[model samples]
Target: MHDSQVFFELLSENTSKEVWADSAYRSEENEWMLKAGGYRNRPLNKRAQQSNRRKSRIRARVEPVFGSMENEMGGLFIRMIGRARAKTKIGLMNLVYHLKRCASLWKSRQ
Candidate 1:
């Protein structure tokens, strides 16, 4: 079981109900407030089922995003310097790619 201090500190202040990752956060006090997202010993509910399905659908979209990043904009392994600079550079690249994708879709309709 993991401590709540690190997770709680990292989370945004607006977050009330903690997303139950696994058995790590399982406890009597957190049982009602926490929602488990995975298929563990924990009981299943309709909301958990829907959340799992939604995560699968979202994972499908991530493939194309990565593919575009690799094939179109070169992989994230490009000769980047430090972590801070690399993050900024990659963020700008993604922005440009998304704009181009929108433009191409718009032009295709014409």
Candidate 2:
């Protein structure tokens, strides 16, 4: 929660109003902060509820992308030492992921 402001500030001007996050991000304070920042928080709830199921369904769509990035694209390890280098490595990985996704889509259209 301490670094929420920093993370929120990292969002670009074109970012959407809704922020999808996990259960760890849920809290009354965080909700107030998110609302104050003009964002609609969609963090998963810890308890068993309808919203929890909905959140899980939403998260399921993105899980495979990260799984493939880590397992197939070798994005799990950061070979760099410094923070800048680490960011660059992750950026490159994201680029590679996009390229691979494009290629897959192109092939599927054939």
Per TM-score, the best of the predicted structures is 2
lDDT of each: 0.68, 0.74
Q: Give the 10-residue window scoring lowest on summed lDDT in candidate 2.
A: 5-14
User: Model 2, range 1-110, lDDT digits (tens) per residue?
Assistant: 55544555554443678676655667887778778988864544566468678887988987877887888887677877899998987888788888998999999999
Summarize candidate 1's per-residue lDDT along 1-110 as a digit string, tens digits.
44564544444453444354555665664454333422224455999889988997997888777888888886878576788888898888889889988999999999
Weakest lDDT window of 10 consecutive positions for candidate 1: 32-41
- Among residues 3 or more apart in sequence or in different chains, the pairs in candidate 1 whose N, CA or C atoms overlap within 3 Å are none
Most accurate candidate by lDDT: 2
Model 2 clashing residue pairs (backbone): none
- Give candidates' CA RMSD values in order: 11.2, 12.8
CA error at residue 19 for candidate 2, angstroms: 29
Runs of candidate 2 with Cα error greater than 4 angstroms are: 1-49
Query: Alpha-carbon error at 36 in model 2, in Å?
Result: 49
C-alpha lDDT of candidate 2 relative to the true structure: 0.74
